[model samples]
Target: MIAIRLRSSCGAALVGVLALATSGCGLSAELDRETNPERKPTPSETRAVLPPVSATPSPSVSVQPVSGCPSSGLRFEVGRVDGAMGLRAMTLSMTNCGEQPYELNGYPSVSVLDEAGAPIPGVRTAEGTDEVPVAPPGSAPEPFTLKPGETARAGLLWRMAAEDGTYLRVAPDKKRDFVNVRPEEPLDIGPENILGTTPWAPAS
Candidate 1:
């Protein structure tokens, strides 16, 4: 009877140990799934979670001339002056902003003016020639037409002078109305009092 009871007790303890070992394996597998879930994201799910991105704006294009277009449909501007030794040169540019084509065949008519807008006396204006080069040699003026948005340029040459000029009165040609343009720097046409101008040519 004593030997039978000892065998039964041993048998019951072995069953309990086997059940605990099986349950421990299932618990370890559950913990692994919770700690490290799979990382596969669907395309729709990704789009829904991310914020929408805005597009960058493009730069604007400039169509108007440097100076505003005027009622005459032309814009006139003086380029920066270039000086060496005593010779001073600058570019005179005109842009056609009108619908009609503008004609040009000769040098622009220009005169220096005082602060009161009166023409300064004793200033000699002449056409530029090879003998008296205004700017580096460029193609001579020929009859040309500038359509809308086209530009023409001319060279102005002078030397520092005794009388300082506050403004320049310019006409596209002798026939057109004069337009007043203030030079970037005041004009100091020296004692020679000469201002030479090249004929209108297309801007290269």
Candidate 2:
């Protein structure tokens, strides 16, 4: 009876040990699932977008400056200026030097002078006559450029009392300094005293 009791007690203790071992293995499996899980995908980088470009080109231009033309750049010559029956005829022509173009407008100041440096009569004159009206009348004169190798033509007509002056003087319009002039023919200053022109114009 004593031997049987010892055997029964041994069997109960062995069963208890097996149960404890099975519980420990299940706890270890739960801890491994909590510590290490499947990895998630890495985040991707964001990119910037740009605006579209146009196909057409922009336009550009250059401008030139304007300047005044003076007397020293011109040459003066004289010829016949009249086509009418009643007036003495002469034309004053100006040529610009090859150096540069000169701006000219209106009529030149003209005078006939004696050798003694006195103003001669019959050469005293006005700007217009009944035979030929002043061109571009009653307005500010437009400036015309006398280019290099180009000429500007003006008319000088008068009715004269005598051919008394030894020198003919010419100046660009309103300019005070005078250049001496020689007519194509010896001027015959008759008895008429009026002097005028058709005004100055660009030579064709």
Candidate 3:
């Protein structure tokens, strides 16, 4: 009876040991699953982020007529402007829109004006093409007559200055009333403040 009891106790202890070992292995596996998960496959394509587009419009030159003909019956317009090496050349034209012939003997009086039509101060006006050599040299003023529907042209030259003008106050001569003419582009005058003009000549 003593040998049989001893064997039975040993059998029970062996079974308890086996249960503990199995439980320990299950707990270890659960812990590993919690700590480290399975990895997923990587995708071949990725999305990209981009910046927002702007809504403001860029500035452009105006093509509409800015002024009407003065009582002098001559219409003045600012023509093409050419720039090179900091020098600017502009063409000024006057059309005889009246019924009779118009007399133009000399260089037209020109002054840079602000948006308010007021002359910009400190700008010097030269009557010949000597100071600014961008345009063709002008001949001395001689009395000339423009028939109706004819046009006369003058060359204006200047270095880039510090001031910008919106309008040009032009007169056929110093004695006539000034007419405002708008250029396609604003005049960008620098610190030089000097404007040179050639004498009125027949447009070829």
Leading candidate by TM-score: 3
Model 2 clashing residue pairs (backbone): 159-192, 160-190, 160-192
The digit string of per-residue lDDT tens for model 3 on 1-204 reads 212332344456567878999999999888767766673444678769785532222233222244554457788878756654456677788888778898889998998876565667777789986776443455687788999889988777777766467777788889988766677667876444778887888777
lDDT by residue (tens digit), candidate 2, 1-204: 212232344445557777888999999878766765554444678878765532111122111112333447677777643322233556677777658776776767877655443456545556654433322122234578888988877666554345554446677776646666544334555333555654567777
Q: After superposition, how far is residue 42 of candidate 3 from its true place, in Å?
A: 26
Clashes of each: 4, 3, 6
Best-matching candidate per lDDT: 3
Each model's TM-score, in the order given?
A: 0.62, 0.52, 0.63
User: Ten-residue segment with the worst summed lDDT in candidate 1?
Assistant: 54-63
What is the lDDT of every predicted structure here?
0.68, 0.55, 0.70
Ranked candidates (lDDT, high to low): 3, 1, 2
- Candidate 1's clash total is 4
Clash count, candidate 2 = 3
Q: Which residue segments of model 3 deviate by more than 4 Å?
A: 1-70, 133-136
Clash pairs (backbone) in predicted model 1:
160-190, 161-188, 161-189, 161-190
Which candidate model has the greater TM-score, 1 or 3? 3
